[model samples]
Target: MADGMLGYGTTVRIGRGATPTWTPLALLGDIEMPDEQADEVDVTHMQSPGRRKQFIAGLLDSGELSIPMNYIPGSASDTLCKAIKTSGEQVLVEITLPVPSGETAVPEVFSGFLKGYARTAPINDKMAATATFRLSEAVEP
Candidate 1:
C-alpha cells in the first residue's frame, strides 16, 4: 500500500489577479478551508399550532479562511499584514494538496477580504502570524 502524503506537502498561495494568474506568496504552516453555511429565515405559520419552521436559505454568510505562518520581514506574513490594512479589499487564496497517486491534484480555491491578522511573540518557539479572511462569492475551486 502507498502511504498518504504528509501535510508538509500542502501549499497555500495568494494573489490579486493582476498578472492574469495567482502568484504564490508566503510560507504557511497551516491553512484552512472556509467555514461557511447557508442562511435561513423563520416563517412559522400561526395556524400550525406553535410549530416553528425555517426557510431553506437566503444568503450564505461570510466564511473564514485562516492561515498560520512564520513571522518574517518581507515574508508572507508581512505581505498579508499590508493587505489586511487596506480598506474593503479582497484577495485570492489557493491551497494545493498532494495526491498519493504520484501526481499533483488540482488546488482548491477561495477569495475573500483580509479581515484580521494576529502576531505572536513566543519566547521559546518561532514567532508566527495568524490571519483571518472573510470569504464570499462561490470561491470554491
Candidate 2:
C-alpha cells in the first residue's frame, strides 16, 4: 500500500465571480496542480566588493493548472470550458484532493481565467481534451 493519497478520487470544480456556484467537471483524466514561482530581482550595486549578484524576490506567480480529460462533445465540462474561454472572465477553480484514511480532503482554490481549451482526436487513440487555467492570484493551498 502507498503512503500518499491516491489521485483517483480527486475532483475539480469551477465557477464565476468572487463567490460562485461550482459546477463539477466530468470525464476528467488527471489534474496537474499549479506550480508557484517567484521572480528574482537583482539588487547589485557598484559598492559591492566581489561583484556578487545581490538578489531579492519580486512578484509571486501561481502558475498554470492543466486538466486533461476524455473529450465528450456537448458535455457540461466541454460547454463550460468553451463558455469561460469565450467570455474571458475570471473564475474560481477548486481542486479537492483525495483524503487519506484518517485525514480530511482539502481543496486548493484559486482565481484565474481559462487560457485555452484544446481538443484532439486520433484514429488509434481515444479522443482527448485539455484545459489550461492561468492563475491570476495566490492559490489557497
**Can you write out model 1's per-residue Cα lDDT over 53-131, one digit (the tens) per residue?**
6455767775787788788867755875666557556677777877766676887777777788778888999988877
**How many backbone clashes does every candidate have?**
0, 0
* lDDT by candidate, in order shown: 0.70, 0.88
lDDT for residue 29 in candidate 2, whole number 0-100: 89
Off by over 4 Å in 1: 2-5, 18-21
Predicted model with the maximum lDDT:
2
TM-score of each: 0.78, 0.92
Worst 10 contiguous positions by lDDT, candidate 2: 1-10
How many collisions between residues are there in candidate 1?
0
Per TM-score, the best of the predicted structures is: 2
**1-141 in candidate 2: lDDT tens per residue?**
866666898899997766688898888887878888999998899986697888899999998999998998999999999999999999999999888679888798889999999999989999999999999885565
